[model samples]
Target chain A: MVKIYIPADTTACALGADKVAAEVALQAQKRGLDVELKRNGSRGAFWLEPLLEIESGEDRFAFGPVYPGDVAGLLDAGLHESSEHPLFLGRVTDIEWLSRQDRLTFSRAGVIDPLSLDEYRREGGYEGLDKALAMTAGEIVEAVTDSGLRGRGGAAFPTGIKWRTVLNTPSDQKYVTANADEGDSGTFADRLLMEADPFQLIEGMTICALAVDATQGYIYLRSEYPKALQVLNQAIAIAEAANLLGSDICGSGRDFHLQIRVGAGAYICGEETSMLESLEGKRGLVRFKPPLPAIEGLFGEPTVVNNVLTLAAVSTVLAKGAAYYQDYGSGRSRGTLSVQLSGNIRRGGLVEIPFGASLRELVEDFGGGTASGRPVRAIQVGGPLGAYLPESQWDTPLDYEAFTDVGAMLGHGGVVVFDDNVDMLEQARFAMEFCAVESCGKCTPCRIGSVRGVELIDKIGKNDGRSANLELLEALCETMDVGSLCAMGGLTPMPVRSALKHFPGDFERGTGNGIER
Target chain B: MHSSGEAPAVIVSSAVRKFADTPGGLLPLLHEIQAGLGFIPSDSVVTIASGMGLSRAEVHGVISFYHDFRDKPGGQKTIHVCRAEACQAVGSRQLEAHVKTRLGVDYGETTVDGRFTLEPVYCLGNCACGPSVRIADDVFARVDADRFDELLGDI
Candidate 1:
């Protein structure tokens, strides 16, 4: 029997992996091999997923990010012989990128078929819920606290503290919200996770509901990810059918229901308050603090809002015990982070590793250098709004505190690499333009500042404009940073300033001033 | 906002009615209605407002808010060049300018021939292949101005 495992990660699906699975099944059958084509989650090496694993004597031989058309070539190479092609050149475990990751949340990510609840259970999916069900709510919170799991949504907020607040808050309609709006540029970890092992996210959220005594949860997904929404919705359906969701989850009498809410083309909605606003079917405008979402969220009730990764990690901690998950990472940042490497890079996709891994290892070793093959000049860590660190900062570790200490926030764990050919000035302008377009425009700083930022950057790019406008630009960034209601306006300056600071040479004034033309 | 002055009430039809009751109905409904009926009609605006129990101004604000939603009919073909970070990293700006010069219209404006409408988008998630543009539902990756011509030539 030729049992082939195809990772069900969304990016793999986008690359037509599902069809490849069917092709593998058909091809294997034609070859007279008993083919059990199972769709598993990605192993986080996304560049290598739809990664087809064929069962060998002791272990499964891997080939990857495979396409339906590649099935013939794969078989022609002698599937029975297995280890002789460029596709399966490396050992799956020896890939330092995957090996270094202490995957608590992502444990079942690339292992089991995302759609099959049976495979999910076999790989220890709902074991977290079982463990959480045995413990009291306080014990559940304490275990999570001891695990030292921080929010992977980029905020690095203590997951336990956030849960505890919602737990302690007296409200009949407390909610567990998963910010599946993985809107950050170059980050597809959430989408990959949801597509690969959606049950992990479900199981995680289920455990949260049980721990916090909440009956309802929502996964707010970005509209750009239409396929992920489909996969997640289907997974949710399967979960509900298997008594893993809705009332009496895992037959524990804990009532939890999950609804997938689609985002309407707004990047700011990725933020907690804005997501809440979007969930309420209003404009995705950021709300003021003091009335935190933990106190009054999603129609004026206490809510436990977390990133998809955060909730998914909860399942691992609960299932394998907190200490197991906590054993990885550096001082403050514990556990592995699914870092998404994208942009101008040879190998682009998710790389789940311990929190303290250096950027050098991620970009050079795992990323395999830039797609353009030029010398690496600047790299934008985090998302579009993240800082553009020069090669000097390449050695910095991928941790929340480390990134923050150096004026960069590891927002959503997306590391977008850029080569020497990258024009930082243009990048800064694009950041402003992005914020301007996606801004909910609820606040003036973002609304006006973003538009102004574009104009000012354009002027700076032009040599005729006064250099004094640079100060004006800085002042505008300060105004937006302090005055803006949300990160949409506030953090937009991070990339802009970083671009101007790191690659000032790229921003030099030429003859006509505005682009090379 | 269309000056075609054809029929005024062709905007919000049955599709809008079907989607108006959905959880996140407004945007998709308007997009569907626009796709069916060239523009979001004044009558349909009222229909959407009444069906969704929203104010006409609120509906109008939403229509105006999103660059995607058009109160007027677009040209026969719409060419959206991704002007986002990834696309920019690989010279989409030049390609955009080239397309604009070729079509003789700026961004968000339609061609005089009514053959094309050029717009800017953030990203299509085809980062590995840069300078991407989505000509309607079909995404064209690694698109330069020259490749864009073949795409534009089709329409």
Candidate 2:
């Protein structure tokens, strides 16, 4: 029997994978061949999406961005005979973008059928869960702490500390949450992981549920990620069917059930407490700290809120042993960071590499430099709230401490490359504008400060430099940094100040220092 | 004002209907409507509001709040150029300017020919391949001015 899988992800379907799958089914039926079709999640290679995988002999032959019209020809060509088909000529494993990665978090993604528990089991999916079930909750937390796994979401907080906090908290009802709301621009690893290997996230959360003694878990995903929600819902159903979820998993006395919650298209919902508020069907508002989410989170109970990558990474660390994950990265940041090499580069996709790889290597070797073949100018590591780095800093090793030393953070390992034609002044303004738009309007500094920031950037851009504007903007940033409750308001100055500092020439070019509004 | 009873029938597809039927279905419902109709039309605002037990004004507010949603119908083709930090680092702004110059329209505006609508998307998850643009649904990453023109010519 031959099997064919077409990714059901919105990105893939939009590229005509659905139509291709239908055509394959129709063609197979017409020929009366024993062919089974499964709709899976995206393979994460956006450029090669609508990627079709056909079972041949012992291996799966891949074809991609395939249209319905090409289905019959592919069938006629016999996927078995040609290992060097235009699509599979570059084998999935051989692709540099995927080949170099230490794929712990994304190990099973794009390989297993997203909805199949049997396949997931066969592919060593829940081995971590099995190990986790055997260990005591404290032991599990210790193992994670020893592993040095940090949150892959921006901030890169230690995963073990959060789990330990939840474990130590006293509560009858505790909750585990996987933050799938990856609203970061130029980032799709969360969406891909959720869609392609939902079980990894589920297994990771299930492990958290056991460790934290949480009875319920929620995968808070963004509304824009429709396909991830669909896959998660289906994966949840399959897990329930397999007794991996619901009351008494694998007939164990422990009871854990998981659900999926979609966030209203608000970027701030990525914040752990805000996600909790949204899960309760209220406005997505940021909560002040001192009682971090791990201690008293999600309706005032103990909660273990983690990013999708953090949870997914937990599975790998638990399954392969802590040393395996601990051995990968530089100081403080452990395990392979799944670098979402995106934006203005030739080979854009997910590449999981050891921490401390130079930014130059990532930008030049993996990213293949700027897409336009223009001279590379700047790069933005992390997300929108991250700092903009010029060419001089390209040699900086990509690790948490190294980035921090340079007044930047290794936020989510999403590196976006830019070319020389970009205007630093405009890019700086956009950061403020995005902050203004996505601000929860909770703090006066963030709400009004962001608006004023945008205006100041524009004024600088237009050469309306009344040196006073620069001073005022800097002062506003200080207040927002201290006064704002969340990163949304706090980090707005990163890009603005960096742009002004790096490209001072751009500001002083047009306007007199004494020029007024 | 058009009579509520005599308003155009907001015929939702089975996918949209299924989404709208779920509890707390407003967000997904809006997403489905946008996916189907390009933008949330005035008719959809009323129908979705009624179906979800939300006020028309509330529905409209939600639709208008997000940058992804648009009130006016988009052109036949939607050109989404990534204007995120990464793309901007690679001179995507210049590419954007060139595109605007060629298309004779600013960002978020449709061409007079109804063939293209240019939008400035923050990112399309193509950072390693910056200066990426999605024409309709096809993402063209690492695109230069020449490649962009070639792509435009094809469409």
Candidate 3:
């Protein structure tokens, strides 16, 4: 009997992988061939989604972009000489997209069954937790600090420093929280990690619990991710049942239990403090600083609030020595960053590479240019809050400091490509409009300035008062940048300013790109 | 305006007990109420508010704060098209226009017969396969005009 694999990832399901998987089973049954079906998570190579793998004759053959109708052909070819067919992508590892890059956190993502504990253990999972059990809490935090692992969340705060804060804070009750509220428009790495290898996140949280001495933890996930919600619930139950998450984890006398809390569809909840408010069943509002989330968070107790990627990376940093993880990237950024290549690009998927990789290499070479084959014009690296870069800046390395120097950000590492025909003015307007819509309304600047921004940008788009409106827009942007409490308002000006700087052609009269206003 | 309808207190009792032991149980209680009854009834707001020892205004604030929690019953099917940067980087604007024309409705508005409701979502976390649409819980990707029409034809 052959063991066949199909992706059960959300993107795969969106691509009709469910129907294709069903067809594969049906076709195989008709052919009277015995086979065991295993649904695996996405390998983050979304371009080849619905990618099916078959183990045959000492090799696992891969085929992709498969549909329901193509399942019959695949069954015939897959059962016999699977690797020789046209759809054959050779070994999935040999694909240049996966091979040319480094993968640290996402190594076992698409390769293992998401719900299977045995498979997770086989892939060297939970070894970090085991290692943490033997070492002192201070030793675990030292390992993370020495490994140069910062928060993969937007802030890039040192993960070890946060655990150290919780470790040092004196409290009867403490908490460790994972910010899975991935509300950014162009980003989905957090969602992919949760949906693929959920246990990795669980294990990472457990290690945090052991280091911080916080027995209770929570994962604040967004409401839109139904698939992720289901997968996480199942994985949590499985982990708890296996004693990987229960009262006595791995017989280490450490008790780390986790719960998944859903966020109401508020983008601002992605902000750490706002997420805390939402978790407590209130209207999501931005909390004031000075009494930061590290010192007084989640019911006024010490909490370790890190992003999904940050926590996931902690597991690997502990499993492999800090030096092993630190050797991959240059500068402050260590280890591989999972870059999401999406929108308008031909080869759109997850590309995990060292931090120093060039943007041109990602957009032109790996992405294979725009899907429409049009000449590329603009690129937005990072989430929606990131600035739009022109072709001239494509050579900038993808490090945080490098992007900051360029007046851009590598937020969540989602790189969205735009072609020559794109309207910079229209894209700029959407940024303000998005901020206006998603604002928590706690701060007046984000609440009021964002609405004013849309109105001013609208006048510019309509070519009604070009010079005057542009002046007002710039002033409004300045106010928002300096006055806004959180990034929602603070960074809304990034796109608006970048568009005016780089693509001034679209802001003129009779040159509007979108349907006028 | 929401229609005044009677909701059994037993249902609210069960919903409250389901998450009563957990701290900050209002959100889960509301989710349970919505999931079980489709929409949170206007009268049931008082029931839920009292069940959680929260004021009616507080409950209403939470229910309206999030986009997903609807006060009234919606159409049978929902078509949520991505309007985020990634989808717009492609041509989802055109898809939005097509759906509006085909369905004869704008975003947040339902069809005349109430068969379908059209809405705009920022991102469905499926940015890699852009121009994505989710009809109910099932998400469809690479959804061009032809594919959308074919999907609607099946419906």
Put down candidate 1 lDDT per residue, A126-234, tens digits, no spaces: 8888889889988999889999999988888999998888889898888999998777776777877877788889889988988888999999987666667778999
Model 2: CA > 4 A from native? A1-6, A19-40, A50-54, A61-78, A81-90, A508-517, B1-155
* Total clashing pairs for each candidate: 5, 18, 0
Measured by TM-score, the strongest candidate is: 3
**lDDT tens per residue, model 3, A359-437:** 9999988999999999989999878899999988999998889999999998889899998878888898899899989
Give each model's whole-structure lDDT.
0.78, 0.77, 0.86
Highest DockQ among the candidates is held by which one?
Answer: 3
**Candidate 2 residue-wise lDDT, A1-517, digit = tens:** 7888788765566556777888998998888878888887765665576678876656666776577887888777766536555655334566656677777777777778888888888988899999998999999999999999988888888889989999998889999998988878768888878878889899999998998899998888876565677778988998888889999898778889888876656788888777777665445678888689888788888898889999988888899999989999888878888888776676666777889899999878877776678887778778898888887788899899999898777788778777776677777889889888788777898999999988987776666755888888889889888889898889888877777777666566465542132
lDDT of 2 at A222: 74
Least accurate stretch of 10 residues (summed lDDT) in model 1 chain A? Answer: A508-517
Q: Lowest summed lDDT over 10 consecutive residues: which window, candidate 2 chain A? A: A508-517
Between candidates 1 and 3, name the one with more favorable TM-score: 3
Task: Give the per-residue lDDT of model 1 (tens digit) for B1-155.
Answer: 34344444544556656866675567667756665655676656777888888898888877776566666667876677767665666677789889888889998888887766787766555554556776655556568888888877766
Of candidate 1 chain B, the 10-residue stretch with the lowest lDDT total is B1-10
* Per-residue lDDT value at A307 in model 2: 90
Which residue runs does candidate 3 get wrong by more than 4 Å? Answer: A78-82, A511-517, B1-9
Candidate 2, residue A52: how far the Cα is off, in Å: 4.4
